[model samples]
Structures are given as C-alpha cells and as structure tokens.
Target: MGATPEEGAAESAAALDEVAESLVSLWSLAHNAPDVPVPATQLRVLFILEHGPVNVSNLAAEMGALVSSASRLCDRLEAAGLLLRDHGRDRREVTVRLSTDGQALLDRLKVRRRDDLARVLDTMSSPARAALIWGLAQFRDAAKADKGPGSAGESFSLPA
Candidate 1:
C-alpha cells in the first residue's frame, strides 16, 4: 500500500529540514564573498531595512533581539555609512533606513546569490525546477499562515 498523505507530508518536512541547512550553507558562501562580506547578523539587519525603514524597537522585535543590541548594530552600520537614521513622527522615535551604499551593497549581494542559484538550477531537470517553484510557494504561504501566536515560527529567530 502507498504511504498515507500525512506520512508523505512528514517525509517532506524532514527533507525540507535538510534543504534548509544546505540553503544556509549556500547563503553563507554566496553572501561572504570578497566584496559583500557583511556578517550574517548585520546582513539580516540590512535585509530587514531593504524591506523598508524600521524603528529600533520594531527592528528588535523582528529580530527577536534586545533593543540595545539592535541599536548597536545600527550604530555600526551608521558609522560605515551603510544606513541612515532619521527622526520619526516624534523626536523620540528614531527610524532606520538603508543608505544608498547599503542598497548598492545589497544589490550586489543579491546578484551574486541569484547567479549562484542559477548555476545550480541550470543543472536541475526542468520539471524538478517547476516542482520546486510550486512547492516553495506553497511552503511560503503555509509559513506565513503559521506566523502568529506561538506558532512554529515563534521559535524562528536570527542567529546571534
């Protein structure tokens, strides 16, 4: 008899875990190249800012880190001219945004990442690539759906 759907899903979950680990290794390799050698934590901060400006408190919450830690990271980025901080609606609220240099850096990093991924995908069968695209979209939707009130994503935090 064929395996039940639930059993198949469990197997897929296990496979996804391995895939996630491989992706992290690939990301580290692609991200830590000669020109784009930002540390992963700081890279995460930049990635967050790429989405839009965020205040220190909100950034800390997103990273599941302390405000002081996030602020320190911001300080470094500011010193490096990688980010800009401006007053928010009130003087007390400091909003952080990626500077032009930061955006350029991220653009370079993303291009490298895409090139690396393309090399690998180039070797995969077309059908397999299609399946991966479809499956990843489903996974993304499910992950998003699972992101509230102590769901599995609650444990998802940036590597310290």
Candidate 2:
C-alpha cells in the first residue's frame, strides 16, 4: 500500500524540520570548536583560498557577497595572518591566497572536526554511516547539476 498524499506531505515537512535542527546543532558545535578563532564566514573564505588564489571580485561573486563585504572579510583574515593579497599579473587586479599559517589552521581544524564527526559516527551502526555517505553523495550530485559551476547553493540540501 502507498502512503496518502497528506501523509507524504507531512513526512516531507518533518524531514525538513529535522534537517534544519541538525544544521543548527552543527553550527553550535562549530561555534564551540577549540582553537578556531575565526567566524564561520571567514573560515569559508579561507577554505576557498586554500583551493587556489582567486581575484577579489571573483571571490566576492562566488561568495555571493558585495565587493566591499568581501574586502572587509579579506582584511580580517589578513590581519589574522591567515591570508595574503598580492597584485595580479595584470597589475591592476588583486589576487587572494591562503598563507602558510592559514593552511596550518585549516588543516588543524579539518582534522579536529573530522575526529569530532568520527566520534559521533562511532555510536551509529555501520549501515547508518553508509546510508549517510550515499545520501550525501547523491544530494551533492543533484545540487551540482541544479546549480551551475561556481554556484554556492550546493552547500545545502534535503534528503528525500
């Protein structure tokens, strides 16, 4: 037997609520993480820079933020010695890249976060972990297909 339309709708709504609550919990955990002094926004900027040096305007576009806002974020990261800005080959453009300290910090944070996640996952059954990995992979693929290259919306999704 199939579920009624109303039942299906209710289930979907409940799933969305659960996802929202999980996101809040994740944010709280990240906020309380040790040795991670930067705000989440700055961390995201550093993560992007870690991939490769990008021009300020491009970074702003990718982050979906105003140029001035991105500039302010860059300034804060630079002040923390986590990023470097240098003149581009065009001389008129500025390129932003992560500094060694930035890389070190990111690496440490990644490891710590991975360990924290692993600890939580350890309590779950293997099948549950596999299901999570599979679900997230499918969600990522769907998101990438929906949003073109350089789109930021790939970060959020709900599993069906």
Candidate 3:
C-alpha cells in the first residue's frame, strides 16, 4: 500500500504552491521588463480593463477593494497614460478603459513572458514539455469545474 489519497493530495498541493510562487516571480519579471515598469497592482488593473471598460464601483468589487482605493489606482494608471477614465452616462459613474499604451505594454509583456517560458521549456526534455502542457490543460479544466468559493464563472483555455 502506498500513501493515502489525503497524503497524495497534500503532496500535490505543496508542489502546486511552489509552482505558483515561481509563476508569480516570472510574472513580476515580465511586468518589470518594460521601459516603464507598472507595479503589479496597476498591471492587474490593466488586465482587468482588458476585458472591457468597467465602472469604478464594479472594478472595486472585482478587486475586493474599497471604491476609493480603486479610484486612486485608476488615477495613477491614468497619470501614467496606461488607462483612460471617463464618466458613464451619469456624472456620478466613472468608467476605466485601457489606453493604446497600456495594451502595447501588455502585448510586450506577453511576448517576453512566453519567450522566457519557451526558453525554459526548450531546456526540458520533449516528454517533460508534453507533460507540462497536458497538466496545465487539466488544471484549467479542474479550475473551471470547481464551483466552490471564489468561483466567479471565469473560464480559461490554453493556446493551441
């Protein structure tokens, strides 16, 4: 008999945690690769805006932050010319949009990060690369299936 399922889950969770940390490091490196480095939090706001324009209140809800804090974040990004802030139909409503510069920054980071990851993958054996791809697909599926807490109906797909 080998380790129990609970033990196996524990081991897997620990490994996943380590991988998450490494990914976060890579993410930070990518964020800083640009000439104008955007703080992680501000980069996050840009990512959120990428989906579409969002009002401050809704953005605050999504960020799990106070509306004032979210507004302040928007102010910094706007000042950096990474995003645009405009009022909704009602003067009381404020909407945020990612500017061309912000989108370009995101595009550059995506290329850099993918290139860095590809370099690492090239160092790995072919079998390992295949395994990593398959494992990531499974992880995406699992995340989609998990409807527990923090589930926001978001789904992700791996590039072909």
Best by lDDT: 1
For model 2, residues 71-95, the per-residue Cα lDDT tens digits are: 8999999999999999977788989
- 1 versus 3: better lDDT goes to: 1
TM-score of each: 0.87, 0.79, 0.86
Give all candidate RMSDs, comma-separated.
3.3, 4.3, 2.8
Arrange candidates by TM-score, descending.
1, 3, 2
lDDT of 1 by residue, 1-160 (tens): 9989999999988999999898777756767887764688998899889989999999999888999999999999999889999997768889999999999988888777778778888999999999988987777667656877777555443322
Candidate 1 colliding pairs: none
